[model samples]
Target: MITKQSVIGFIGTGVMGKSMARNLQKEGFPLHVYTRTKEKAAELIEHGAVWKNSVQELAASSDVIITMVGYPQDVEEVYFGEAGILENAKEHTYVIDMTTSKPSLAVDIYRKAKEKNIFALDAPVSGGDIGAKNGTLAIMVGGDEDVFQRMMPIFEVLGENIRLQGGAGSGQHTKLANQITIASNMIGVCEAIVYAKKAGLNPEKVLESISTGAAGSFSLSKLGPRMLKGDFAPGFYVKHFIKDMTIALESAKEMGLSTPGLELSLRLYKELAEKGEADSGTQALIKLFE
Candidate 1:
């Protein structure tokens, strides 16, 4: 059972991970941190998070390890090698991969973790940096019921909407579904604002009206203003969103599902990335229209 006394080790202190870790620390969980770039973790270190030099060291010392790295490759790198979490963490330690990664990878991690008697969960999140900072992310978890219950205290510190989706890779599958929805919705959000501006309508006032109507969406209400103001700072990066869309596209293909909108969005984002806005926030998609 995880308690406040359980030592939490966090990996990947980028835009979202840093905030998530800070919230955990604020809730008084003893925190140990590791990241490829030590500089990104400076704030947490100053706030009393013990910094580990590598994944092995952090895994060896932590009772619960939460990873919010960038990609599936990074997830595998941190969890599968000689210096990885599975090899270094003590048996029965709860390991949660919060990275938005492959469902297959999540299942593989669960199986390998079971072989070593380590508990594993794929708990990806939504609401981006804002949610991470505010501790209101929608956490979609894939793991055993008992384990989810045991980790509730920890999850509560990081998010308000939390649910056990199913076994093994379900959390990742759910996150893919979320990304698919966002992929298409973003295009529409960008188009609406562009149209409003071109038609001489005040986009802000238009948003104020439509944001609460059938046209309402998180992207519209939140990222819409960001688009209007040309504030493209990444609440979620265009590059990462591209990675997610590619993954979702692959997964959809494997399932014999067709995602026309997802495909169109992916094509547009790749064009945006090629034009050198990959590092920009996803709201920058509006620039394609501009």
Candidate 2:
């Protein structure tokens, strides 16, 4: 039996946030949502969500606050900066940031939440926009075990995989690992499909063959097909993925760690963005080569 009294508040509605909030609504949770782009909040509002005029207002009224903004800075601004969650924090607030952002930022926010006696979890997620739309993200969470337990039901609503990595920034760091693997795999899919196109072997057919082999991956199977058809309408914006990569690089440098593969991915994504597909979905990265 879950507590029905908890009202869920969500920030960042561009893609993931919208779907996640809608899922909560479907599960019979009263939802309040705040988005920088107010227009994006329309569909969710139609689904029975109340429009939170601002992050602070959302923070004030909700029992649990979830964030899924685009970048590390956006996460920071919504949670701790002016007009942010902290501006309207009340006792016993549970704040979860599900953005794929820098680990250190997660740590800083966690500490701030603790000082205010609020429960904060750094819970970055995977599974992209498609998953969000379908209510199946993979959540990597870090915080107190009790709080993690408290959030499990909500996690079950939003993600397929709900993992507890460690405390404070562990979720974000784990998400970095997830991003690193994705960077490599996305590049792999792009290269393989590009080669198939050049060879006139039918990129889709080649994908059908290898997608069941050891090279099989979610990217190669789902996103690879999308890339092949040039359907890059933002399953996770290239711009947003690049921002996540930048967060990974910054965190790696701070830890005195080196990631050459991620560096190459950064460069490739930068070039892709430079070619003007940054606003497109991560699959649109293949456009750089086309």
Candidate 3:
């Protein structure tokens, strides 16, 4: 029963979270925000989001809490720490985690939340920075179906294509599958550009020829131009991409599935990370070829 009157608490105001939180504000929900760095949330604060000094305070006051933090460890800390969400959220409050994290952790949070009569959802999203700013992300959710339905209005505000994949942790599993595709796709995008360059064809012209054809993909169409212009800035960070691939690799191993392509992509990303490109975007994989 999320309404315009529901007090929304948002934690994590980084590259994507800031825009996502802004959209919620635009929809007229009163937003309470908490981030590790208060300055990171200055714009939202200026736009009428009240900044809470602690997670416990935000959880206690908010009707619906959304988190888009970094790393599985960070997720664990925010939800399970001494002053964490589960410890402080009011009964019947809805807690949604939008971070790309392990499915097991999502299930764990769901179980813990249910014991306290709270509604918990793992609703990881795709589409990176551009998607966040444009409100065109694809949100994959896992939780009780009724709870998913309850959060549709909020989801609609933040994403274009939203789906309830299944029960607890399903959203994270689906996100892992999405990351698997992107892992291979990013490599292909990098190789295509590198191949075009080596063959003395103008890579931009080559992109024009193939981008609309079967070879076209999100990475090629969106991140390819950035590659051509040597804009290795992060639409999504290499460290985060590596974290995702590592999770996918571990998840695949658990399911007794083979993921050779994902493995190779992980290796390449690890190489780039080792070379101190960890803060760069995934498209910076082209640096490997250079």
Candidate 4:
């Protein structure tokens, strides 16, 4: 039921956020944008998006506010601080956080927003930069069913696969599960290429063979090509991936579960980070073998 007149305030303009916000603009939604560095948001402003003075100002002005920021701490600062979203948004405003963050934080945001008579959803996404650019992200949502249903039209413009997993923090929990798989899968993708090189097989041909079979995955098909091409520019940052793995590990421990593969992946990624590869794209994991 959200129309083009529903002003959208978007905080975060890096990587995927830029494209995601652009898609909303393309859908004719009036957009208000803000980022730490105003220069980073210039592109959106040039494309008819309005610039906001601060998070508080943006929250006060928009009908729906979406945040896709970095790290759990950033999420906390923007939502829980004195002049934050929960403090300034009007009653019944929809606040959707698309950041991959701690589930407990998401639940806390939901509870806090509800106390203010606001509608909130934790909607974490996957599919990376390509998906963001192509408007095909898989959005996992956790919130009231009624609010989710009302937001479906907006979700449709921003993503292809959208699902409501449960209430409050469930979307973040689901995203942590996703990160667990990607952590191990990235290792597998790197190893498969390494093994191919060791055995004197063309890694590209190996990719051709395995990518269509049971070994196929989003990482193998997409990131594998970037690896073969030696393009390590980040579609997703190694540092961010490490943060995700750390969260997943913490959450798993809370549940009294063990994730050995996740543990191994985190160790290796931390090694890469120590090597100063933190800003490089996640496909750079293959460089550990080379």
For model 2, what is the alpha-carbon lDDT of residue 259? Answer: 91
**Which sections of candidate 2 miss by over 4 Å?**
none
TM-score of 1: 0.99
> Given candidate 4, what's the lDDT at residue 192?
94
Q: Estimate, for each residue in 26-124, the C-alpha lDDT of model 1 and write its tens digit.
A: 999999999999999999999999999999999999999999999899999999989999999999999999999999999999999999999999999
Alpha-carbon shift of residue 104 in model 2 (angstroms): 1.1
Every model's TM-score:
0.99, 0.96, 0.98, 0.99
Rank ordering of all candidates by lDDT, starting from the highest: 1, 3, 4, 2
**lDDT tens digits by residue: candidate 3, 93-127:** 99999999999999999999999999999999999
Candidate 2 lDDT = 0.86
- Residues 132-175 of candidate 2 have per-residue lDDT tens digits of 87888889998899999988889998989889999999998999
- Give residue 134's error in model 2 in angstroms: 1.8
Mind giving the per-residue lDDT tens digits that candidate 4 earns over 1-290? 58879999999998999999999999899999989999989989999999998999999999999999999999998998878999999999999999999999999999999999999999999999999999999999999999999999889988999999999999999999999999999999999999999999999999999999999999999999999999999888999999999999999999999999999999999999999999999999988878
> Which candidate model has the greater lDDT, 3 or 4?
3
- Candidate 3 local accuracy as lDDT? 0.95
Stretches off by above 4 angstroms in model 1 are none
Clashing pairs in 3: none
Candidate that beats the other on lDDT, 1 or 4, i.e. the better one:
1
Candidate 3: list runs displaced more than 4 Å.
Answer: none
Better of 1 and 3 by TM-score: 1
